[model samples]
Target: MHALFKHLRQVRDGGQRREYSRYLAQRMGPMIHALMLVGALAYLVAVIAGTLVRHSPLPLWLRLAPLPLLLLIAASTRRVRQPGLLSTLTLLCVALLEIGINLNGADDLHRQSVVLPGLLLPVASSVIWLGRWDFIAAMLLCALGPLPMLLSGNIDSALVFQYLVYMAIAIVLSTVLRAFMARTLFEQFRLERQLREQANTDGLTGLLVRNRFLELARSALAELHRQRQPACMLFVDADRFKQLNDQYGHAAGDAALVALAATLRRQTRAGDLIGRIGGEEFAMLLPGNSLEQGCRRAEQLRLSMHEIRRPDGPLTTSIGVACSQRCRDDIQTLLARADQAMRQAKNTGRDRVVCSPDDC
Candidate 1:
């Protein structure tokens, strides 16, 4: 059906609709956790089989059964949740569960209490997921899960005491390590976000740079295509910029350019893309705009630039407007049309707006 295909398209692109990916990642963690439990069962069976068969070493196939599951879990964890936290907790739980059953199967002299150390790991994880105060409460429950076995005389008295000491040490160590790791992850994520924002934005005017402009334009075009809507591109060039730079000095020229860039930002909508493409040349991409609307917007920008004449010398700007057509799928074509129109505006006279050939 059309609806089914649309849903598939949304998932396949993995853009804008990222909740599905997040959900998939979250679910995969539990699935891998289930796989770990299966691995524990398989490992138990292999140990029992080897004991009964009186084999010095378990068969390679039996030993290999859990290896694949471990690798799968390790690989899958990175794609789902925070690897530092979720994977560590999963590994700790699996280790505890494995040690618990192994201890249960050991001979009287070799038996040791491992359940306490193992159970405390999930408590640490719960603490990480919740908070430190909540974890303290959760740790009590964790201690209780292993206490029944230790108090029932199934485990040796010395082993129980040793486990209690070891559990205490593990609780302190794991909590400290996990807390440090959690802070490190949070710091890294915050730094990454800041860097991404810096990269997308211009240093001087706080507008988007040319590189980011192209990215946003492409993304907008994709959305426009989906909605069957038209968009427009406007290219603006400061008239007699070279003359102004020569007469008033480059610093004054720079100030004028920055002022113009600020004007563009103020004039455009939240959805519009405004970028300084080159020295004294800027571009704007407006979605859901027709050729006439594009012309009016370009005229408005031109008038705003004319009104804000620099103190050293009056400044003027020329604008070229191009609207997307039935055959126009690429940004370059729209830009070329706008560029041609801008050149035409420059040729005719300064401080005027020019319409694209498509508009004419």
Candidate 2:
């Protein structure tokens, strides 16, 4: 049983470093399932071995007598699905099995020897599956399992007692070790998740970075095409940004960018993809929006920007709107058209909205 518990921890730790919770769950979930299956299979094999040894001439049945109890313990574990509960139950079942084996075989020397190792199984189960209290429960059972041998003189009383005491120490030590390993694995998982978030997010706008933004946009584009769904993109560039940076310091320029990014975040819907793709340039991908709807949204953003009072007084944006079905399958091509329209808006005058001619 100690060996079985060790096997479980080995499998669980093997996949705990995955970066995403979804991927981590998917990876470890299978290994845990496989561990349970293997434990169950081992129990069945023990039962078969017990049955075959029952007819042996040398009384191997007594040596393998606790095998049925171990089988019962393994079978009980499969019934509980929740991790903490299952672990506790597995430990309790093993402890109870040890008590039963000890009581029934008080006078059989070989049976007593087999039951001593059975005591270790409970300790292992408690360390691997259950919490501290469960570990103590199994440890107490370990103490009890050997006392019958000491009482009946089936084994040297002092030697059996000494071995029992050593097993108790081992159980406590194993439980502590297991807990440390579990904590380390969880910490690694958290760090990996944080690293992934840092990689996929932009520092300036706190929005999805360019690569992640494009990946999401491409998927949304594919879905829109399949459903013939309405969708729009608003390509926004801060008007006179280079002049602003030159006249005011770059510090003031950064402040303006931050302010605009905050405004865009507040203005966009929860499902919209608002991303910073380049200096003073951002884009919004809005699903379920047509050209007319996009025009209204872009106008709202334009008015909002004009209303903002920065340290440099105010700043404005030039926006170009492009809706789905206005162009071919390429996202870059669609964005290029939107950029051209934005350039047109800038040429006509800044702080204005322009849409594709098909939209007009």
Candidate 3:
């Protein structure tokens, strides 16, 4: 029961986890449609068989009662966007079919065998494509499908006991199978996420890698353009970084880089993008900031870097500030200008902020 509730919570929480929800919906939609179509065809064949070979005790209309529901389910599966909704509807359709068959075939012993096997279909479907609440709904409906027959005294006591035992076994098996599949799917999603992070992020600083940072900067620039807002880019290079590396070991250099990354993360807004674009250089994209605002921010960052203490001495950074309002340039061109400004700061002094010449 605890496991069942845990699975239910996972399904309920899936809306917050968009990637997993989308993947589940895409996979389950086709499975539901295919299963409904096959079920409809099999029912059609069964009706023909009953009419030609052995006269069914139930009326033809009674046996065909679930056909329209099956078709409706198939159509709905294609249109429904949420996986939880689709699974619920599919389980309901299966349950309705089970009830209809049991009620229609209550008088015949041979018909009971055929009708009872239909109960397994919902259990199997729920195991393969649904969560705990869905599975429970399917189990309840399928298990109680023969209840009307039992109440009416149509089925013998021995047959009733046997059917109940079969249902118990089916439920247990379905539960186990659902657990295994859910765990495997979760592990696969976790691994894929880790791989994506490794590809996009720097291993040392945990900032965006050079190429990924450029891609994101381009996206941010496009967004700012659409909003008719100004955006700023800051190109930051560590001052006298080679001297620090020469005096200390490479490990000290790595630690300084990591510390710089942490400082940048702390000083920037949540929406800002920070990246390690080179060995001793980093970049930041600040959306909605004009040239004047960008220069102020760059100066603040420069001061913060100077305050960062290292084993050898205090660290300092040279920052170049560029803004979208300064000129009609693409992201790459703006970044190039910012890099040139940073070089100017480097040439004049070791630690300072410089705006683009035109903007200055």
Best by lDDT: 3
> Across residues 76-195, which tens digit of lDDT does each residue of candidate 1 receive?
554557434554555444545444433443332333424433444553454233233445544554554465555554647776777677767766665665466445434444466579
Worst 10 residues of 1 by lDDT: 1-10
Ranking according to lDDT, highest score first: 3, 2, 1
Residue 207 shift from truth in candidate 2, angstroms: 1.9
The residue ranges of model 3 lying beyond 4 angstroms of the native Cα positions read: 1-16, 26-33, 51-89, 92-115, 144-161, 325-329, 357-360
Q: State, as a TM-score between 0 and 1, how close model 1 is to the true structure.
A: 0.61
TM-score (all chains, Cα) for each model = 0.61, 0.63, 0.79
lDDT of 3 at 205: 97
Q: What is the C-alpha lDDT of each candidate?
A: 0.65, 0.66, 0.77
Q: Which segments of model 2 are wrong by more than 4 Å?
A: 1-21, 55-182, 325-328
Better of 2 and 3 by lDDT: 3
Clashes of each: 0, 0, 0
Candidate 2, residue 118: the lDDT equals 51
